[model samples]
Target chain A: GAGVSQSPSNKVTEKGKDVELRCDPISGHTALYWYRQSLGQGLEFLIYFQGNSAPDKSGLPSDRFSAERTGGSVSTLTIQRTQQEDSAVYLCASSNAGGSTQQYFGPGTRLTVT
Target chain B: EDKVVQSPLSLVVHEGDTVTLNCSYEVTNFRSLLWYKQEKKAPTFLFMLTSSGIEKKSGRLSSILDKKELFSILNITATQTGDSAIYLCAVLFSNTGKLIFGQGTTLQVKP
Candidate 1:
């Protein structure tokens, strides 16, 4: 892909139901990240992956929120037993490397937990 | 806790008016500061400042970081209606890809 891509541009789910958002990062990129943007708010760091393992899961928000990347290409963010507060836009980004490099972002998945 | 704060949560301006957006941060480790412009969906990258006093310019948009003051400012000259968007500021960790973002400034450029 020319840039990062995310799935299900818009998603609406009932409270307590689980949801999965997907991201396909640019090829050969070694770093992938997930962020949550609430209404009128900035991007909130959720998780980061280097290769297939996530070194920094410090921002996962809660145990119910988990993300994994396989083949260093595609990643999935799963929200278990979603709450109304989980409604937000989930953004995914990929960089050639981590840190100092600029990250390319996806269109983002708008998750609405009713 | 790392924190990034942006001022003037919202702004209204006319075309051709120059605007300056402010960002200040409190972080344990500061590698670089980045600016992003978001219109509808995703945020597009603008500028990344690592050295203090050096300005990164792209057309009418320029940004400079001040490590001493722990702040950065983005200036848009002769703004256009297309410039109406949410301007975001983020601080990057030196060794990781994690970015701590500010609340963002919503700029409305009136025609």
Candidate 2:
């Protein structure tokens, strides 16, 4: 893909329901990252994947938040038993390398937990 | 803990006016600072400052980093209504490949 792409641009779910958001990173990019933006808040780091290495899950806010990247190309963010506070824009980005490399972001999925 | 702070949480400016947004950070092993522009959805990358005192320019936008001061500034000269958006600052830590973002400065440009 020319840029990072996300699925289901918008999602509305009832509290306690599980929701999955997907991201397809650009071809050949080795680094993928997920971030959450709450209402009037900054981007919060969620997780990152690099090749087949153990993902850096230090940013996952709670046990209910989980993510996985397969084949280093696509990634999914899952929230179990979602809460109203989970309503926010979930963003995904990928970089050719990492650190100082520029990250390309996808059109985020706006999740509205009711 | 790593942290990034942006000033002037929100600003309202008239078209043709100049504005400056500030971002300061405290992090371990800082590698680079990035500037992004956010409208309704995605945040588009603008500039990445790696070295100190070097200015990066794009059209009416310019940014400079002061590593010694642990801060960076984004400046817009002769702004337009199209420039109305939230400006975000993020710092990338060395070896970690993680980004810590500031709360962002919301700029509202009126014609």
Candidate 3:
């Protein structure tokens, strides 16, 4: 079984630039989540999608951050206007339909806002 | 405001020594507690505790949760150098299914 996968392993962008990070969940995982880990800090929840339900955006820091899951398998997290504080490793994780299951994580995408 | 906290933000120990990491949380509708080990970009799931007093064990690692006190403890017996990594604790909310994580504990094991 293929694990979760993320794209653009590392990205260096100038401040104010918009960046989109992609995540491909496991073949049948119905619950997907996005998290951000700043340097020397814990992972901060970003967003979550479960099946066809409305996505949970409470964890998103601001309007500049948004995410969408298409076809229930892939998700994209967009940071509209990047700031130096936005520089962090963005991690994607997925689990079975039941949220109680342990999530499988992917090799995160490191975004560096210059 | 729901939050999770880990004690001894950083620890140093020699191989073969036993160590215990602590996690205390204040969250509403707590469903389960999880433990993860991160040596790199990806974090590997270690344990998920849902019941109080029941210990989950794997190899040299074990964890116990206390719902009464709203805390959990992860213990490693006869630690190895490979155990040097960041240990993260997270609490899952039953209502939203989102995990609130603690600022992980960094462990350094010397050979």
Candidate 4:
């Protein structure tokens, strides 16, 4: 089976622009997650979706960060007014359930905000 | 606030040497701890520890968790050049599915 996958492996955008990153979770996975890794920093949790509903969005940094999942399979993370500090690798992961199983990761989308 | 910390931000070792990576965390309702090896964009899962004082082993890698101490250690025995990569430690709490990750430890195993 195909593992978790994300689109736009690399993206470079000017600051103040908006960017939408897409993610396709594994088949039959009910839980999806979004995280970002900044330069010289660890992975930071952004948001999590259980089915089509988002139950835990506390990790979102600010109002510019928002994520939505459709049909409980695909998700999109939108960053509004991207800032230079937003440059990082956005990773997507999925699991069978909320937090009981091991989550599989995707190759990630590296966003460079210039 | 929940936080995870790893020691020895970077390490250099030769092949056949043994290395130990440490992770300590502070979180509410801690459920389990996980270890991952990241060489590229994707991070591969290594182990998940839920019980304290129990060691999980696979190949040359082994990890043990200490709930009382709020820390865990990942030991790689007979390390090879292929072992060079960034090791990440994350803690999963009972509240949500979000994982709190530590600043990874970069290991360099020279041949």
Q: Docking quality tier of candidate 3?
A: medium
Q: Which digits, one per residue and each the tens of the lDDT, describe model 1 over residues A13-104? A: 99999999999999999999999999989999999998755469999999999988877789999999999999999999999888869888
Q: Chain B TM-score in candidate 2, rounded to 2 decimals? A: 0.98
What lDDT, from 0 to 1, does candidate 4 have? 0.94
Q: Residue-wise lDDT of candidate 4 within B26-75, one digit each (tens)?
A: 99989999999999988899999999999999999999999999999999
Displacement of residue A51 (Cα, Å) in model 2 is 1.0
Model 1 interface DockQ: 0.93
lDDT of 3 by residue, B1-111 (tens): 999999989999999999999999999899999999999999999999999999999999999999999999999999999999999999988977588889999999999
RMSD of each: 0.9, 0.8, 0.7, 0.8
Cα-based lDDT for every prediction: 0.94, 0.94, 0.93, 0.94
Tens-digit lDDT track of model 1 for B3-100 = 99999899999999999999999998789999999999889999999999999999999999999999999999999999999999999999777899
Q: Write the per-residue lDDT of candidate 3 for residues A1-114, one digit (tens) a residue.
A: 799999999999999999999999999889999999998888899888988999888999999999999899899999998999999999999999646889888999999988
Superposed model 3: Cα runs more than 4 Å off: none
TM-score between candidate 1 and the true structure: 0.98
Q: Give every prediction's interface RMSD.
A: 0.7, 0.8, 1.0, 0.7
Worst ten-residue run, lDDT, model 1 chain B? B89-98
Per-residue CA lDDT of model 2 for A1-114, tens digit only, reads: 388899989999999999999999999999999999999999999998988889999999999999999877899999999999999999999998876598989999999999
Query: Candidate 1 vs candidate 3: which has greater DockQ?
Result: 1
